[model samples]
Target: MSIKSKPTLQDVARMAGVSSMTVSRALTKPDIVSEQTRQKIDHAVRELGYVPNLAASQLVTRRSGIVGALITTITNPILATTIETLQQGLARAGFHMLIGETRFSQEEEGKLLRAFLGRQLDGLILAYGYHSPETLELLQAAEIPVIELWDLPEGEVPRQPVGQVVGFSNWAAGASAGRHLVACGYRKPAFFGYDDERENLRFQGFRRAVLDGLGVEPQRYKTSAIPSIEDGVDMIERLARGELDCDAAFFTNDMQAIGALFACQRLGIAVPQTLGICGFGDLPIARVAAPSLTSVRIPAEKVANSTVELLCQRIKGEEPWAANIDVGSELVARESTALRR
Candidate 1:
């Protein structure tokens, strides 16, 4: 027996003894079609191995069914989890995610935003804090729902006439870290943070909390470049050789803290005995490290889910309240920062 030609809607209609339009209605809008007709169309589709072209169907529905996402980088573990969760949430809502990485450049973000707009995306999600004037113009022209994640930029309004924003307070996250250190009885503390503005916000919060909450002004050690394990180790070594005095240090992130933990071990400095250490963003490595890192837990998955939900509501033309979601971070005291009570 010879294999038959690939089945089309016409073929399914002929097999099901219905008009092509009736078959289309049965497949696309089953509720509009009688149950018997819908079952017959489904059976015919199964028998013929007919797969409807989603793109063609979307054209008829006037829904591009795609969401454009822009972020600084994808390699970071915490960001990777956020994107994964966002994609999964969007997929459940019958939407696809188109991701673009800006590498932390405003110019690059502007270009990427233009490209996404060219694709006529259903919605937009931006991760970076800065936005170019050109990018803002494009966003205004596109007139689609845009969700800014992670940290909100200083000047931008929470919700635009055409778009929406969802984010948490970066400053609050840092303040939590400072309070944690102060509560743990670290008076002469120091801060190690990256150069990013978001990190700077955290640093400011940490500084404020130390002065206001702890009644002591903490010293700061700003990293010239991005915070990394090597930087953490180097900072510890430099501090050891200097006259600068600090009983504890709060690294900008857990990765850096873990590095400091190793450096302290090499120098024979007992953690929480002679010196204490803490970090932010309780990544997986934080928990599994030698000392089992004590850091702030930022809900990466929750942020993604909340952003997507906000975007969905915006897409449906429903005016959602300004989503200043402060999925607050909690300080998890582990062996690294815990003092024997």
Candidate 2:
């Protein structure tokens, strides 16, 4: 049997009766080429089954048409929504996304940054605003638009960002959750969360709210466990067994809150009646839990949209009017924190 060779740009140009340069422009910068010429080039490309050499095209236009995104994990419901929306938005703009998991590790993030930079990504989206010194250096020298999502930089409005930021205040969200718990008459609240910068900000805000509302300090439990239902179950079991002391508890995310709810059911502890519960990142499950959980709802979709908009603008050599976008968060009062008896 004879072997068939893959079609090339020259084949398309020949079939379309146009120069190779014209075909190249039609493929990469269709707007610049006339509509009639573009149609001929498109038909010829289809007929010849010619796939443009992306690497060769990148050399000419200095654009990879690829964007790199780094997130803590792909499993978090809140971050999952953000990633999905971001991918869809980038697709609409003729770009593709390359996702990486940092697992909240600055070192892993720095390593991924080096690898992504080697690929010459046109832009980068980071879920966390904080970065290691080496990662920051890489970003500064990369000369590409970098947009931070999920958490805003701490500063004044219109504050200068590394490049751009599209997220809400983690501190404000935690404070909102704390205030809601207090409003529901939960005194001596307990916090079950991580001891990282973002979660620490939340804890600080929560502490401030608890102090101001009830004049009592919230008991803090630092956990290095992956935010999961089992961990939440263990924490709630401890509360039930008198191992921890608090009338109310706040978790870092909804999965843990749901877990706590499960434990409460098994241990015969009525939610909101005996112990109030609140969580951040109001996942869909929080709304339908046995006793619906009250939680801070981060604007994942809004952040994703804003990140794509600003990134696309920067990639096109346009300055976004707003470099810092604070979508803000809402604390939804649900059954879990309705009232204290």
Candidate 3:
């Protein structure tokens, strides 16, 4: 067969020295076919670049075998773990995932959702809970199993989730970091992060903790830019220049915290002594940084497993035992925040 020509099932079977029915059974129901014959069919398909007609398969099975995932950005190391795990889990269950970057915009998310819906995906997995009204309406109309990640409302019913929700409380994670800073004997802590709604919840929790523990409100420093190491470096530089007044700072994620640590070293500011630092999302670098970072650890794998399990259940026309699953977060104490009182 010419490599440029579209290969068919007969071509594959002819190359593999098997009948068309045997090749079909091997591809669709391999368990019933002998291992030796299945290997020949696979080798022939690979050589010919044969692509199965997913349209025909879907028409018969009523399943597209595809899931759509939307996230803020692929650059954030913190979210990378969850996405990798979700992809692996979905692939294990014979489902392929198509991912889109929303860049934290409702308009972009809605556009991606519409594109995915047109393909008739079996389900969708979203990074955060908040969505545009149009996006919500689309999900309602699609009526497929949807899983929202990263911001579960604690003890309160969510207005979204046409299906299941799996995530931790951002507010709680921030509060834990704030209390950790207080325990380290730092006063006048400040929040340094993005101005997104989810980031705002973390700031609110951190503020509540600082107010209760230190009897003073923490300062707020925010930017609309996505949180990055450069942002963290700039924040520390501002503090050194007296542009901000705070003894400690809680950042949005480990990237910022790691950046702050590097900046402190360059500026001669002693961490946990002259300035304390903490961050959310205990990315791998947090454990190995010079002073190490104090951060909140989100259960990425747990969330992934639960999300896949629930989504599969919904796909099977079964209701999940529970709609909301809060895997929760934990504060990891480390050298960066180990201030001596």
- The number of the candidate with the highest TM-score is 3
Please provide, for model 3 over 1-341, each residue's C-alpha lDDT reduced to its tens digit, 9 standing for 90 to 100. 66777999999999999999999777655657898998899999999999988899889879888999999888888778889999988875668899999988899999999999999999999987888899999999998889888887643343555556898887888899888899889878888888876787888889889999999978999854566888889988988999999988898878888888999999999998899898888998999898989899998889988999899888878868787898989999999889666
* Residue pairs of candidate 2 with colliding backbone atoms: none
Model 2 over residues 1-341: C-alpha lDDT tens digits? 99999998899999988999999877766657888898899899899888888998898888988999999888788888999999999876768899999998999999998999999999999888777879888988998999988777663343345777788887788888888888888777888898877787888888888889999889998765458888789998888778999888889889898998999999999888988999889899998887999998887888899889899899999879796888999999899988765
Model 1 has an lDDT value of: 0.79
- Superposed on all Cα atoms, model 3 deviates from the true structure by an RMSD in Å of 3.0
lDDT of candidates 1 onward, in order = 0.79, 0.86, 0.86
TM-score of 2: 0.88
After superposition, the stretches of candidate 3 with alpha carbons farther than 4 Å from their true spots are 1-44, 154-159
True-vs-predicted CA distance for residue 144, candidate 1, Å = 0.9
Candidate 1 C-alpha lDDT tens digits along 264-335? 999988888777889877899888887788888888898899888899888878887555665666788887
Candidate 2 off by > 4 Å: 8-50, 155-161
**All predictions: root-mean-square deviation over Cα?**
4.9, 3.6, 3.0
